[model samples]
Target: MSEIAVVAISIAKPGCEEQLRVALEGIVAPSRAERGALQYDLHRDLREPRRFVFYERWESEDALAAHGQSAHIGAYRKQIADWIEHSEIRVLKKIM
Candidate 1:
């Protein structure tokens, strides 16, 4: 099966960019170490510092699901619950 791609966008509350960035940064290494993690990347919008984006590729849908239930991810979510203003996640299937 082909890999699954995930695009997650997070927006920090006004004035909480640094706090959000720190929290988001904490997830990258651990997430990359997961069993089925293929690629994990975080990006900051040049025009909007408070906006953060995650691009991830996983071995399968099940793997992606496991990533969501990962202990580190759970912890990260709880840790940043109040630091973020909005978040969106999209799962994609490659076409080419």
Candidate 2:
């Protein structure tokens, strides 16, 4: 199966940046250790401190799907639902 990549972005609500950051950071380690995870990195926007991004690579679509269904991810979504102002996620396939 071909590898897949994902880019996820989240913008925190005003006054919730630090709390959102801590919650997001808590998922990194466990996500990286999951099955079929090729890369899982978290980044913060320099100009917009409340914006955070997750750069991820997975073995396949199934792998990425599994990741989305993970316990941590569910907990994370519930935990940050109120703190996030906006969010986006994109799945990609390399062509070159």
Candidate 3:
């Protein structure tokens, strides 16, 4: 199997956790339907409601790149920016 992934770490503005959750839920379906999306999951910190993460897997680098420009993903980023404090995004390739 191809092994490519993306990890997104986001900190929501104070009191914006629920809003962020709603926004993230809205994008799930579209992300799953994308051409090479193998998996996409959203996670929240158990101890910190304001912290969130997205774990995504794709078939290849090209597929992941395509996701970066996808309409749903773009919309999510734009809409959530106002509710977010900061974000760190990284892409990875499996070695083991």
Clashes of each: 0, 0, 0
Clashing pairs in 3: none
lDDT tens readout by residue for model 3, 1-96: 476999988898998989998998898889999999999998989998899899999999889888889999898988998899989989998888
lDDT of 2 at 12: 99
Residue 40 in model 2: shift from native, Å? 0.4
How displaced is residue 9 in candidate 1, in Å?
0.2
Question: For residues 1-96, could you state the per-residue lDDT of candidate 1 as single tens digits?
Answer: 679999999999999899989988999999999989999999999998889999999999999999999999999999999989999999999998
State the C-alpha lDDT per candidate.
Answer: 0.94, 0.97, 0.90
Highest lDDT among the candidates is held by which one?
Answer: 2
Model 2 bad stretches (over 4 Å): none
The 10-residue segment with the lowest total lDDT in model 2: 59-68
- Candidate 2 lDDT over residue span 3-96, tens digit each: 9999999999999999999999999999999999999999999999999999999999999999999999999999999999999999999999
> On TM-score, who's better, 1 or 3?
1
Candidate 1: where is the Cα deviation over 4 Å? none
The positional error of residue 52 in candidate 2, measured at the CA in angstroms, is 0.2
